[model samples]
Target chain A: MSEKIVITGGTGFVGTHLILELLEQSDAELFCLVRAKNTSAEQRLHQQLAEVIQGSDYAPELINQVKKRCHAIEADLQGDITSLATFIPSGVSQFWHCAASLNYEERFAAEIYDINVEGTRKALALARALNVDCLNYVSTAYVAGRNTGVILESPMAEVQSSNVYESSKVEAEQLIYAQQDMKYRIFRPSIVIGHSRTYHAINFSGMYGFLRRLIQFKGMMARVQRGYLERESIRMNVDPDVPINLVPVDKVAKQAVAIARSDSSNTIFHLTNRTVPTVGEALEVLFSTVGLPPPKIVQDTTQYAWIDEKFNEK
Target chain B: MPNEIFVIGTGRCGSTLISNILNHHPDVLSLSEFFTFVTDLGTLIPQAFPAIQINGAQFWQIVSGIYAKQNIMLAHDIAMKEVLYPFKTDVRFNASTGVPAILQTTLPHLTPKYDALFDQIHTVITARGMATAEAHYHALFGWLAAHFGKSIWVERSGGSLRVIERLYQHFPNAKFLHIVRDGRDCALSMQRHNGFKMVLLVFQITEILGIDPYESDDRSWQDDLPDELISFLPESFSGKDFLAYDVPPSLYGHYWSGEIMAGLDVLDRIPAAQQLTLQYESIPNRHPQYH
Candidate 1:
């Protein structure tokens, strides 16, 4: 008999990849918790899965297999999920909670708390109600906020976080630990991007937000003066030598599922890239791709001119 | 001087709420913003601790002196929301006419008849002979606690953690309740606060000009100050412009972390038994009334 798995955030970037990984790795019947917007939950999950699978160079028959094995139960993790325990089938061995609000701005702080912290509370309650064998949580590696030094793949100490999103994740991780009796496994993935092979991204934020702004600025500047970007340089107040850890979604999903399948008990796995890229290295690729001059990374702003400030604002 | 406890934290970390909670307790006489009002921003440690002995008149002057930041805020009509003194109802002091340092937050937080309380405190504080500043504080807080029929006193001022070392020197026997919140939330709250905005701006002024604007008459760096921060200085600062300017929250975040890091060193000097560290997030579970 195949395993029965229940997962939330099946419509998300990492969730779609996880579904593919689970399907490829084992004969598991997937029950996805999806929030219906205009269409049915099943439709939403299928649509996201189709885009993710098609975007990658995977075989066409994967979608058919997904359609056959994967089932979507209409549920909002932010709302009352206690009733979901009855809807989901029994004998489910794995419960993966991947839904989270990625908004890090201060304005959407309350909503972020609602989705990230309180939503986890509801997810945990539903997981308990369902009596799943293990609760597999997808947390962010940035939970170790502002701590300079080596971070271990274990329980985090008291941390001083900089934003609501990271703080909310820290709180969520604490909530998971507070559930001592329940068996659980935690995955802390760093800055997830598009698949390594296809580079197809559903959510265009974080690193991509910077990319979009650069491209948009280039387009705007070209209309004002031909070959303007090629001539003039922009100043960014970023340390070009600083390392940024960016992991691919497919790799994160693959590692997460592999650990989940193993007999690991109450362990934390950091799904991060071994080789991190410097800000200058990443910017070089971006600049070359957009046909713009490389930005002058200025850590000091005392000598910044008006034009330098304006260009950096973009 | 009965039992003493200073509830300290980086400002906007729910210290105000903690002070209010302590105020409601039958055995605790909560002193709100006492240290903040009495000490100047530039000379917080020296002013607060005061190694030398001072007469009643000098102590009264320290208590009633118009703090430069407070004066600026009042003159600009940008008083912090934490200044709970009912300037509208009280005839003696309004925003234009200066409110005494003690009357600003401490006395008003204690009672509705804060004007009468002020008169009573003035009579007691000024009648005393020369004594150490710490001794004067003891007599004052001890007298206040006795007058209110409380057995213990807890003095909580927003951003008191910055001067925790000086506080330890003055009140060596006092227990310290260090209430901390998430730095991000603290920074967000501090960014919105008029008092902290002025303080951060003053900090920038100090860094750029090599002189504390609140302490020195040297306006040498007025021209040297950055264009973005110059408007926030006390001289040209206005309520409208202050609110309109979106000061980066990260500045406050850095300030919060700096204070916490410095405060931890001071806390380490004190015995572990005298200290009680509480997370602002966890306080609700311990004291539900705080909710």
Candidate 2:
């Protein structure tokens, strides 16, 4: 049989894209690990594959082969993971672990570790049990934490994360390193945006948060626009100049699969945009999208302090 | 310690705006979301020596816990699973945390020396023997005032008016500033905010479990509450019909009316001088800045 490969988080945004890229690029039989929350694994797998093909501009022949070769193994990485051993047999050639809990809140620090760290550990364990040849781990560039300046493509050590999610991913990387016996390649991608050229988003996060806020802020100002209610100024605390490295999801998948396919072992690669957009630029687009004025990003709480007060009134 | 002021409102009433104006005075210390923080951390109260008496180390523990649990998680989706690591040297104490968000947003100069200020506050709180959560409140206010050279501190937290009775019981001498907003507008706003949704869910869960949510000693609410409900607490539970009772979006009107009545009910027990009502409509919109 052609080289058999198993992957976790196969139904997520990045995972689905990776599956399609792998299907077209390689002649490999793929066993995808999917989570079944309320639906059966087969149905979720179908939906995940269907969404990709529907969104992509790939040929019908390749897309058809993409659906046929990719098999689904239903499992929850955060749940009783022992059940994972049932569907797949031993000696899988390659294992790509791409699952993560992307929540950044300090309150969710614990859950982030549970899913990102523990889940990675479990995936590694399953890889070992199956005696996999190579393990490809997908991580984030944010594992650099709050550090500024250029981050080298190397193992991050003695770093402090501003939030729990970053810290948890850092811990996951450490956990992987601790298992020195395994041959693994880590792919660290910066903030994954939609398709580079199409701009079609399968999942909305990061930049989406600002866009959604614009819409919500508009709702607050909607009545005022109609002259039914008086307008109120909202005080926000965002620093407009912060730079965000937004990487296209398509590019991330293509590069990640290429790196995984390479002979390099225990190497780290940063898949990021060459020119990143600043927070100021992102906000401009966001405001225009929701038909609102460019937000008065007020850092002076004393002069514009009423902004927070009025904003929170809702 | 100087006198304490409490601003109770259903939110969307611009109490924050009032606090913003008041905070311009060097003598006035605005404790944004102060009571809300206490209420969120009230679970730790039972562990206090006398149901609320926490020492300096314990006080600091609560402070860091607030950063980890409350401040970090205010976004509604934040959940603290197993990583409750103590306050680190590098982590920022900024907008993500409840009270600090106000300071970080308005007064950038106020923070840089935040850690030193917190240490000083911890020393004073720990030095005193707090017998009740009210006692801790008194110490907190005093520490804040003395540290900032402010003689008066006003407590401002949106939606705090829902549990005004706790404030009345704890700080009887405290002045209450009631801000009222148009219920319809507020109701429409509530349906969109994750914070408001979480507040309503907690209230609903407490009602279902038959426990007083505001009371610190009612620990059984956590035990009696379903796992599904508990799971939702860590994340924003969007499903309306999942709970024992379905909370329709329209109920926001009833919620607003109920809170206004509750605030009014609590106002009756206080002296006329101690209670003041500020209608949101009274404030004129002079700013044409909003589009």
Candidate 3:
């Protein structure tokens, strides 16, 4: 008999990639928890998968496999989630909880905690009630915020988080640690981008968002003054020598699934590139790719030019 | 009987010196930069003078809250020379966490112990109930006159002539003091002044863009800006950079002429008893005669 797997956040970027990876990895039947009211959960999940597959340029066989082995169950983590225990079938060997809110601003602090910390508690409770063997969590490497020098893949110490999102994840991870009834695994990936080969992403955020803003500035400058960007350099506030840890989504999904498949329960994994590009090196590539002048990495804010200040505001 | 007076000019004139001189008078409560704190950047635009009634807290916020443009100036240390707020020594507030509007010039110039004065004023003002803007201002000024043992209060603010319409609308019965100066000399003085330069740049951009870029959310014309003029825009330029950029004296001279004409157009409507006009050059020689 094949194993049964349950997953949440099937509509998200990382979750979508993880689902595809799981489908390719094992003969397990996948049940995805989707947030839907008017529309059917299957329809919503299929719509999301179609968009992601198109953007990612995945092979045609993945859709047929998803249709055959995958099922979508309508559920909201914030609502009466006790009913989820009934909907989720028994003998579900693995529970993958990947849902999280990425907003870090103070205005969204409440929502971030609600969707991230509180949502994780509900998922953990459901997993416990269902007597799932192990829980696999998808978290960010940034939960080790404000700590410098080599970070270890062990239990995290009490440290200051730079943003609301990081702090919420820390709390959620702590919540998992207190659970003694079941085993849990945490995957911390750093700045997950598109697949290395396709270089396409359904979500245009993080590094992609920065690139989009740079393109906008380039277009604006070209219209304002021809050859202006070529003559003048845009200033980026960053340490030139500091390495920016970025990992491709496919690599993260593959590593996470592999780790989950093994008997590696109650462990933390760091899903990041072995060698990362420095701020200056990455900026050089981005500027050249957009055919604009290389950025001047400025650490001192007092020395910021008027244009630099304006762009920083945006 | 207590008398209320307002000394108005196109700033960079002799208003600061006049206010300083009046500060010494035993019987007069000199309210330096009072109107400046009330209105946004000495602007007499109708938006600055909403006739709506508000509670004491709202009024306090209006008079105490630092405007965004003013915050930029304070943050960059590009505030006008007349601003005597002890930012370096003040403990509670700074440029980043904004110093109150009244504390910027009005309260500090009156006394070095501005913090205590601020606390006292806050207690009194915030305790009062809802009232018209005019009534609230009069109540505060009247209370100040009584507290200082003075028979009258005279308010003076730089570039106050620009806000003649506001003053005229609010204080219909009060006496007006118009100080005149040579447009060329005023323009020369204003050319080097960072505050004037910033205000002029904002107005110029508003005129050229046909939209108030700072106030409006529309960025459809972001690409329509002239390259040379784009850097001086409020969003694009910091206060320090703006201070370094040189605006022509000719532009200030033209601005002075227009201000004088517009001010005269409003001042002409009031009674002769309420209006008094004096030249900037004659003040030094005729000081004793006026006193």
Candidate 4:
């Protein structure tokens, strides 16, 4: 039989795509742990994969292969990990822990710690117990936190997070690194976007949120055109030079699966765009793509004092 | 018939907790925001017409449909009915004139034959496959009653007071518990909560209805009772008849206090045999009087 490989967060954006890519090269039996609430995760995963695969002429046959090999096991990372043990058969070869709460504005800090930090710790414990051949954990490149200017692919001994989410991820990464006996591989991908051609994916993250907001603003403007309200040009401070690294979802999945399959001892691979677009250029492309006039860009970030003031007002 | 208890409070008051607690009661099946009519109309009006703004007649049709199909899944049935007939009447009425006026003119003029035709659509929905409108309502109420197993059914929905009179019209035996907090704190809390901004918009509309906008340290309500709310209240009852229960600004504190007080007030109004009031602080503490 094929090697048994288990992945958590398989229903998520990156995991869903990554699992599909993995099914192609390796004859590994892929299992993903999905949260119980999403009863239709398998269906959703299939639908998303079909959208991506159907468009591609080369990978048309991989659609049925993915459906046949990939299986979703219901278990929440925030809940007891021991419950998941029953799903994994005795001789599991590889385990991938990809689940993490990526929401920036999670109300409680403890919730972030519970899911991101404690959850990783539990996954590591489970991996150790199973005696898995390889444990490939997916983390974010932002685990470097607030440190800007040439973030190396190497792991940092210390991190300083600007937000609770970043801090929790940093903590989780640190916990994973501390597990001395575990044979681990960490894949840190940058802000993932739609597949290369259609710029479409099932999950929404990073630029997707900004795009949604822009679309809403445009809709509001359309309403104003009908004499609802006077059209107002939204202004924002975006540094023209700040490099915004956005890797396409398919590229990230492909690179991650390749790294997982390779015999190289490199424990970490930075799945980031080597040549990233500037913040200004990215915004221009995004607005133009959606048929909206580019926003009036403010040079100084300090000029947008109202943004902070409004948040403080709350 | 099981006693129908409603915990009516502004948004962000501990309605979820109250629902969960009531859910624990063997005789009580407390549901969260079963605003079947509003949610259905909200989705349908936007989807079908797309151009026309939602009005009172569209709302009434949605509500009437829900009342017409109450035996089906309370929420899903209403949603489906609205989707089936997005417009109030077959007249294809002017969108600019608004829904309420359209409904008033259209409903009374419609022959009894048309009403029967509409009712037939609901019956068709009830008889359909798995996840049918009836099944959804059954699952919703059944989950609540079976899980809690209490003799009473309590439903806590945000902005319920906005439609309390209408709700009372349908469930005549229903007792309302309106939980009020300090306006300022409620507004601030609302700024964080999901439906608070919409409620504030409703408050703004109430101001347009010629009521005194009662501004406090927090936010203002028109004359302690907004005109819309005043219209809903019995004509015999004045602004003073509705009681204001003050709550602290802390999370869940305002909600719990308002819920307990609303229940107590309802209990006081009902004949000695019919009502029971339970406090939030007392629930966890296990107060003997409440148990």
Candidate 5:
């Protein structure tokens, strides 16, 4: 029998892409836990994978081999984990827990607690229950929360952010570290952007949504340019020299799956760009590409409010 | 008090201009779509009603429980008085706390039946002193009028035309201003506006209502619409129905016209005096007529 690997949140952006990458390396039986409502996960997975493989010039036979190796099981992380006992049957060789609520504006602490912390707890419990050989978890580098500067590869001891999503993830990391018995690897990725080439997939992060909004605003302004359009750029407490580390989704998945298959004992890897683009450079690139004049970057924290406000308005 | 007016419309019409013009009013509190309210409704309401079981109750109970909380009432008052009543402050407070505060304060007083639980939840939320999110104009209008002594409140919410009836149910005294643009221009604007999601949403809604959304102009509506929307359509409608369907005539003109007409019919059920209609083209030329 082929080795079994269970992936929770496989219907999400990262998981969808990760499954495709994993298929290229292993002929393992890949089972993806998807929401019951997502009856089309199989179709979506096939479609997304087909696009990626086609771009790489992989033969149709190879693509078929990848598809035949994958399967999706309807499951909700918010529900009881014991319900999955039947699916995994006694033991699974590996597990990936990538499910999370990434909404920054999530106000309910309970929900953040439920999905991020509680969901992690359930996944951990399931891994133990299944006696999986190894467990790999995907977390965010922003789990560093309000802390600036070098965010090292370790569990965050303290979290400082008004964003419940970040706080909850920090809390979840604490829970993961607290478990001494479970052998696990954690991948902390920064903001995952579109595929390196296409920039495709439903993106709702970092500069994508903001740029989309700005473009839409530009379109609106084009329709009626009568208003006094005041455009100003400012810098802030965030080091403009500090690189904005954005990992492409394809790279994140490829690196993560490759690392999981390796025998390295390193429990955590910060899957981030070695050299990040500074806030100034990011803004310059974004503004020019979006057809907005380069914003005047004032190096003051007070001016940060204006840039922050623009994002909030979107 | 500042005259805050919201011009709600279906996506891609003229809501941006309506909001911009209203912002120009020296005494008006105008805002674009504050999507946080809908997106975070699950979390915000429960914060206001900690004792209430979110999944256990009926939908109305959940809504009533949120409305009955005391902080919600206070937040509503504060938002109207501080943000909406005076036009001087250009800073928009985050809706995160204001929404729950409004629900915390108002829900209890409005419904009194949940007063006990409301008081309990109110104590917890106020103790934290977090800023509540402002309710969308639909929910905030009545509270604004009752507390701030305003007779008319205008709210501009894009894609709100789909729920004009819900707004009416919430504030019977509230009036709607439906602003539409030339369907062709709107559709073309949508294409340029990264409105694939909006186009898909419109298509799906139309398909579900058993309305054929094809036009004679273009055969690429399926490509133009997002996959999310295509998935939402009735299974009976084939991708071909979406593809071969006319674009310029249907999506850009007649189909949108039909949707607008259907929305107007819903508004027509309200007293004729309570609803007003405008075209995007007319907005730049004419001053708004207030009763």
Candidate 6:
């Protein structure tokens, strides 16, 4: 039988990339679960797909191909669960659960759980209802939380998460692994950024968020205090040594699709970049990106704040 | 004791210093840069309580709804916590932009517990049902004046003089204080200021991406900004290697000239009794607000 794939969050950055990669690699029929309220699901997916492929290696051609082959299954992840079964077609060979709430703010705890945890449960429920062959769960490597040392691609005992979103994903992972009958796979990607080769990233979260804010800040200070740039060095509290695993969108999609295509059932794959960049290096790139003065890394803050810049005139 | 006054002038002038002097006065409550260039102006405030009394809860939410700092940060895709609530180990107090900058510099002592301060102000405002950010400011100023037995309230922030027309719409009977600085000096100062540079870059980057940050819905420019601009944005970037890619001083000069003319026009519209103009050279002569 031909490979019949059903995916959620297919209109998102990673989802779009995964769709394009799958279209190039496989002859499977793809169903993308997109939340379409005002516009049609296909219309929303097309617009998102167009945005994702802009300035990439395959521009119009690949997008057009996916547009023709891909089907937009209308379903809201945070919406009614029973309605999901009605939206998604029956007999889905594999259900790819990629949709998630990435908000890490303290205020978004309820919404985060609603989408990340309950949404995953509903997706898994839909998979079980359809009696799908396997459910591929897209997770984040940050689920490793604040723990140090190298992490192997293996089933981990439920541990504390770095943030609320991470914790929600951990809950979702537990739900999947706890399943007694169904075969499931978990793919955890670390800090997804722009494309590796082209640097074409559709979403502007994570590193982009940090960099964009930093530049705005540097510029603001320079304007508020004309001599802001004249300062010898700027400083942040981020650790100097820990490596931040940043994988490109395309790389994550490529590796993820490769693993999803395998026959192995309950395997966990870490879709991470080989050469991880340090937090110091990341901050360096950020300050440098806007041509602003770099801050000297200081582990001690109280003495410096109270003593060095007495009047906060630094 | 709600004697409203505003210090209007082209940015990069001595407006901050003047605001400082006004702030120190026991009879004056100074609010620096309440309204200026921002993506979200809390537009919902103006029409919110039109000719009606808003309850405390309803009015407080409106005032706290759109933090100008939060808006600017969101516009730049930055998290407010990065600057507003710097981590425990963060030595330097880096409150990045907008009204937050005023608070960061003027009240640096609040840096360690700025969030606590914000929460307190939020609680106080919500308790009384402040209608808008303006209303919240007025309320804060009222409290300040009441605490210090001051009757006059003055707001000063650089470049805010450009938005005098909007201010006039809101505060028609409010007094206007104009501090005129040399246009050339203002331009040079602006060219070096990071905020001015950012505005220049935002304009250019928007032009390159064909999206206006002010009016357009196109945010693709954020991702498409030239690599040269982003070259040294890293924290470990060499301090000595920092080279400013600021727009020409002439552009800033043009901005200053345009703002001065516009600000002057707004001042002219206000009754002569409520308008005061002071030259930069006449600073030693002292001003009415000072005494």
Clashes (backbone N, CA, C under 3 Å), per candidate, total 0, 8, 0, 12, 37, 24
Real contacts recovered, all predictions = 0.00, 0.00, 0.00, 0.00, 0.00, 0.00
Clashing pairs in 2: A107-B79, A107-B80, A108-B79, A110-B81, A110-B82, A235-A307, A301-B106, A313-B12
Q: Against the correct fold, how does model 4 do in TM-score?
A: 0.53
Model 3, span A129-209: residue lDDT tens: 888999999988999989888889876797689988899999999898889878899999998888878876777556876
lDDT score of residue B113 within candidate 4: 46
Top candidate by TM-score: 6
For model 5, how does the per-residue alpha-carbon lDDT over A88-203 read when each residue is reduced to its tens digit?
Answer: 65547888999887665543557768988899999898888878878888888888878977777877776686587788878887777788656788899988887778676654
Tens digit of per-residue lDDT, candidate 1, span A160-235 = 8988989999999889988965789889998898889999998855677567556655653442233556776777
lDDT scores of the candidates, listed in order? 0.81, 0.66, 0.79, 0.56, 0.56, 0.66
Candidate 5 lDDT over B1-291, as tens digits, reads: 233344666556776567656555544444334321231211232232233222312322333332211223223332222112111221222232333322332332223343344445444333332222223223333443444345444555445665565556545666567787777766565443322322444434433332333222233223223333453333333444434333332233333544465577678787777767787777555443210
Residues B1-291 of candidate 6: C-alpha lDDT, one tens digit per residue:
579898888876777668777777777766655443222222222433344555556554543344432334333433322133342233432323333332332223223455455566667666875254446445666764564477887876557775677677667778888888888888887766655554554444444445444444455544444444432222222223223454567668656766776667777788999888887656875453322
Q: Clashing residue pairs in candidate 3, if any?
A: none
List TM-scores for all candidates, in order.
Answer: 0.52, 0.52, 0.53, 0.53, 0.51, 0.56
DockQ of all models, two decimals each? 0.01, 0.02, 0.02, 0.02, 0.02, 0.04
* Residue ranges of candidate 3 with Cα displaced over 4 Å: A37-39, A213-231, A288-291, A310-314, B1-291
What lDDT tens digits, residue by residue, belong to model 3 across residues B196-225? 877766665554454666567566544434
- RMSD of candidate 6 to the truth, in angstroms, is 15.9
Candidate 2: stretches off by over 4 Å: A220-242, A298-301, A308-314, B1-291
Assess candidate 3 and give its TM-score to the true structure: 0.53
Q: Which structure is stronger by TM-score: 3 or 6?
A: 6
* Residue A112 miss distance in model 5 (angstroms): 3.0
Query: For model 4, how many clashes?
Result: 12
True contacts kept of 4: 0.00
